[model samples]
Target: MTLLATHLVSRLRLKHLRLVDSLARSGNLHRVAVEMHMTQPAATKMLQDAEQLLGAQLFERRPRAMVLTEIGTFVADYAARLLRETDSFAEGLDNLKAGGFGALAIGAIMATTPGLLPRAIAELKQRRPLMTIRLIAATSDILLEALSRNEIALALGRLTEPKDALAFDIEPLATEELWIFTAADHPLASRESVSMAELARLPWVLQPHTSPMRRLIELTLARQGLGSLDNRVETTSIFATLHLVREAGMIACLPKSILVEGVARGTFARLPVALPNQLGPLGIITRKGETPSANAADFIDVLRSMTAPGEELG
Candidate 1:
C-alpha cells in the first residue's frame, strides 16, 4: 500500500474526522474546539495532523474566517457523510440488540398522507413490529429537497420536473386524479354540472404558483383559452384551502383522495367540470445509485402490494 494510504488507515482517528466536519460548519478553529469540547490548540494540532497525513493543506488561515482549500472541501464533505453513516450503523446495532428492526425515515406529499402512507405503515408494522419509522408530510418540492440532502431514505411524491428523473430512481406507483370542489352549501355546489368559465368567475383557493397542483391548473386553463386565475388566494396548506372553501366561499382544485372524506361528510361538494391537465403520476423516489436498506425495502414492498392489481391507490 502507498505510505499515505497506510498512514490514513492506521493513524486516522474519529476525532480528526469530527474536527474537519465541525470546521466545515463553523469555519473557526476556536468555535469548532468549543463545540467539540477541546482546547483551541488541540483543535489546531488535529488539523495539522490531518493536513500532514493527507499531504494537502486543508484550511487557509484568514484574519476573520478560515476558508477551505479545494482538497479540504472534498475531505470535509466525505467526513460529514462518513459520520452520518457511522451514526446510522450505531443506531442500527442498538435497535437490533433491543429486539427491534432498524429505523427508517421517509417523506410523503400531503395527498398521500391522508390514506396511502398510513396504510403502508400499518402493514409494515404488522410484519416488523419493533421497526422504527418516521414520516414527514410536505409538498413534493420540499420532500425532494430533503431526499437530496439525505434527510429521508425514501419519498412518496411527484417529480417536480423532467430533470428529477435523472437525479432519482423513480418508480411510478399511481396516477392521481385532480378534482374541483366547493363547500356543500355553495350556490355552484347544487348545480348538476358547472362550466369552467362560470367557475372561473368565482374566487378560488389554490396552491402557490410553484406547486405542481397550481401548475396543472394553469395548464388546464390555458388549454381551454382561459388565463390564470386573478381572483385567487394562494396557500400550500390543505387545511387552509378547506377553510377558505367552507367559510370564505372560495373554490379549490385538489386530489380526489384528499377530498373524498370531506365530500362524504357533507363538508364539501365536488364540481362537475373536468380538467384537461392531470397531475403527474405519484412515485417512490430514492437516491439514484444507492440501494435501500432492508427495512426500507420491506416498507416499499408493502406499498407495492397495496397498489397491486384490483387494489389501486384511490
Candidate 2:
C-alpha cells in the first residue's frame, strides 16, 4: 500500500467521524456538544480539525446553526454508513461470544412478505434460534440496490431474465399473479364480475408511478381506452394501501398472495375481473459471487422448501 493510504487511518479516529455525524444531525454546536458528551469549544475544535484533515471546510457556519456544504453532506453520509457497519460488526462479535449464530439481512418484495417469507423465517427461527434477522420489504429496484451495497445478504424478489441475470446468481422461485381488490363493502364487491371499463370509472388507490405494477395498471387501463386512473392515493406501502382501499372505498392492484391475510380477516375483497395474470418470475437474487454464511445458507434452504410444489424452485 502507498504510504499515505497506510497512515491515513492512523491520523483519523472513529470519534472524529462520530462528531461529524452528530454535527450533521443537530447542525448546532451546543446541541452536538451535549449529544457527544463534549464541551462546546471541544466540539467546535473537533469540527475544525476534521475539516482540516479532510482538506476542506465541511460546514458553512451561520450565526445560529451551521449549514453543511456540498462536501459536508457527502462526508456525513459516508460517516453514517461506516458507523452502521461498525455497529453491525460489533453485534457479530457479541453474538459469537454468546454462543449465538450471526445475523442475516434479507430484502423481500411484496409477494414474498405475506406468503413465502413468514413461513421460512419461522422455520429458520426454530432451527437457528439465536441468529439475528433484519427484514426489509421493498421493490426489486430497491432490493437490488441494497444487495449491491451489501446492506442485504440476499434478496427474495423479482429476478431479471437472461440479459441482467449475468451479473447475479438468479433462481426462479415462483410466478406471482395480480388481482384487483377493494373493501369488502365496496359497491362492486358483491357483483358477479365487473368490466374493466366500469371499474376504471371509480376512484383508485395505486402503486407509485415508478413501480412495475403501476405500469401494468396503466397499460391495462390504456387498452380499455381510459386515459388515466382517477387515483388520488399512490403509495408503495401495503398497509397504507389496505387502509385506503378498506376505509375510503378505493380500488387497487396487488399481488394475489398479499391479499390472503387481509381477505382472511375480511378487510379486503377480490374483484371478479380478469386482470393480467402474467408477472416475470419472482425468485432469489444473489450477487454473482456472493457466498452465504451458515445461518443464511440454512435460511435459503428453508425458503426453497417453502415454495409450493407446482411452483418448484429452479
Candidate 3:
C-alpha cells in the first residue's frame, strides 16, 4: 500500500501540478502552456495524464476558458498545499546542508519598512549575505492572513487587536511612540506643545482607513473630543505621505523612527503634540508551535538583539 501511494504521488509530478494550477488560474490550456513554456499539445497531455491518474474529469471545457469541476477544485487546492509543503521541505534540507543559512518569506507593514526592518535586514545581510529574503509589504490584516496560511514565515508590525485572534505567537520587540509630523516651516512646528483639539484643524495626509495606524489615530482623536480629520488625501505610500507633509504642509501621524532622520536633518519637523497614549507595540509574529526555518530563526535572534538592550546571543 505504501509503495502504491508513493507511485501515485510520483506520477503527480511537479510539472503536472504546475500545469493544473496554471490552467486553473488562467482558465485556458493554451495560456497554461504559454506560461509553462511548453507547447499546447504537451500541456494537454499533462492535464490528461493528471485526470487519468485521479480517475475524474478535472475541468469543464468552455468557449473562452475552462472551469474547474467540484472535484477539480478540491484537487487543485490539495495540489497547491502539497507543492507548498514540498518546497518548504526542500528549503529546510538545503539550509541544513549550508550551515543554517536559507530562504525566508517575511511580511511587514509599510510602517516597519523605513526603520525597524531596514536595520534588521542590514544586520542579517552582514551575518549571512547570501541568505534569501522575500519581503511583502502589506497591512496587518493582510500580513496576518498570509502568516496564518503559511505563505510567510514571519511578520513584523504593530500588534493586531484582539478581534483578530489567530493561532499565532507574538513576541514584543519595541514600543514606539507615534508622532505628528509636518513640513519644517509649518506653523505648528514652532509650537512648544499643542493639544489634539488645536492640531485637528489642519488638513491631514492619512493612511488608508482600514489600516491599524489610521484606526489608532481616529480613536485617539475621538477620545480627545476632536472629530476625525477629513482625509482629503489618503495614501498607502509612506514615502508619498512624507513628501506631501514636507511639500504640501499637511499633517501626518507616523512612527517616531520613520521621521527621526528627517527631523534631525531639518527636512521635516516633529509636531509638539501632547500624545501620552500614542504608543504602539511592534513585534515578531509567527505560527504557534511551528519551528521556523534556520534563516528565519537566526534573523529573529538578530531582531531580538537589536530591539532588546543588553541581551547576549544564546
Overall lDDT per candidate, in order of appearance: 0.86, 0.81, 0.79
The lDDT leader among the candidates is 1
Q: What tens-digit string does per-residue lDDT give for candidate 1 at 118-145? A: 9999999999998877788877888888
Note the residue pairs that clash in candidate 3: none
Tens-digit per-residue lDDT, 180-287, candidate 3 = 888889988888877778767778998778778788888888887878796458887788888899888899987776777889999888887756665456678888
lDDT of 2 by residue, 13-39 (tens): 789999988888888889989988889
**In model 3, what lDDT does residue 112 have?**
68
TM-score of each: 0.75, 0.82, 0.74
Top-TM-score structure, candidate number: 2
lDDT of 2 at 83: 83
Model 2 quality (TM-score): 0.82
Higher-lDDT candidate of 1 and 3: 1
Q: Order of candidates by lDDT, top first? A: 1, 2, 3
